[model samples]
Target: MDVVVARIGKAHGLRGEVTVEVRTDAPQERFVVGRSFTTDPAQAGPLRLRSVRDHNGITLLGFEEATDRTAAEALRGTLLVADVEEDEDDENAWYEKDLVGLRVLTVAGEEVGEVAGVDSRPAQDLLVVRLASGREALVPFVEALVPEVDVEGGRVVIDPPAGLLELDEG
Candidate 1:
């Protein structure tokens, strides 16, 4: 199946290298040299990975299809896709697409909301929950705040601190 590995960010320099908003957990494996990825818009790629580098903690990638700054800049915001076999046995992993739309509840089984999206940051991922009142909550995806993720059960049990859930509330 096709899975999003990363999204093209801004052009880094005069070269074709572009900063990427990595989506997959294993970027070193996914964005290796000579790896080709199918682009979401279709016209921007099949971009072949010509070079990969790290600049001040950001991942910069050069594609064979884009050889200059303008070419790389044109690919900004395009999603890079790769084919991968699903590992159903991996219980510890959860993709953004899999977590989105799942029911979110407190550990005591109180309805909280549904997962709207996932914000993948450098330190930890944040689960964007759509609350009943229509506001969104950024639940830190951690063992303490989010104890259980029952994908099969279509729910995630969160154990938030006193005011964590009310962060986005009025």
Candidate 2:
């Protein structure tokens, strides 16, 4: 499947170079010359990496056709994606894509809801679960509250503290 790798930022220089906010866990080497990826599906066509270099902590990329500052500026905010094969991860880790739409169950095996979405924040990530009562609950994605996640089984076992569900009712 195609996964988002980065987002094109402002033009870096007069040449066709642009700053990119790296989003993928893969290293910079993976985005080197000859690598093929796509920018915004609506506007940009396909982009083949002519070269990729790091400046400070941000990434600078040069695409085949983007030969000037004006061309690079047009690509600002475009999401860059690369086609990748499916792979397994370590036991405790789970992909955000896999968590969406899975059922959520309490520690005692009581069905609470389905996962509506996942939100990443500076303090902590949260699981937006759509409860059976048709209410939304923003549960903290922490080890204390979320004990287990079974992607293949399509369920997440949670251990919500007292009054957690009640807070969602208000």
**TM-score for all models, in order of appearance:** 0.95, 0.65
lDDT of 1 by residue, 72-139 (tens): 99999999999978888987788888888999999899999999999888888899999898899998
Judged by lDDT against the true structure, how good is candidate 1? 0.90
**Which of the numbered candidates is closest to the native, going by highest TM-score?**
1
Global lDDT scores for all candidate models: 0.90, 0.82
What TM-score would candidate 2 get against the native? 0.65
Candidate 1 global TM-score: 0.95
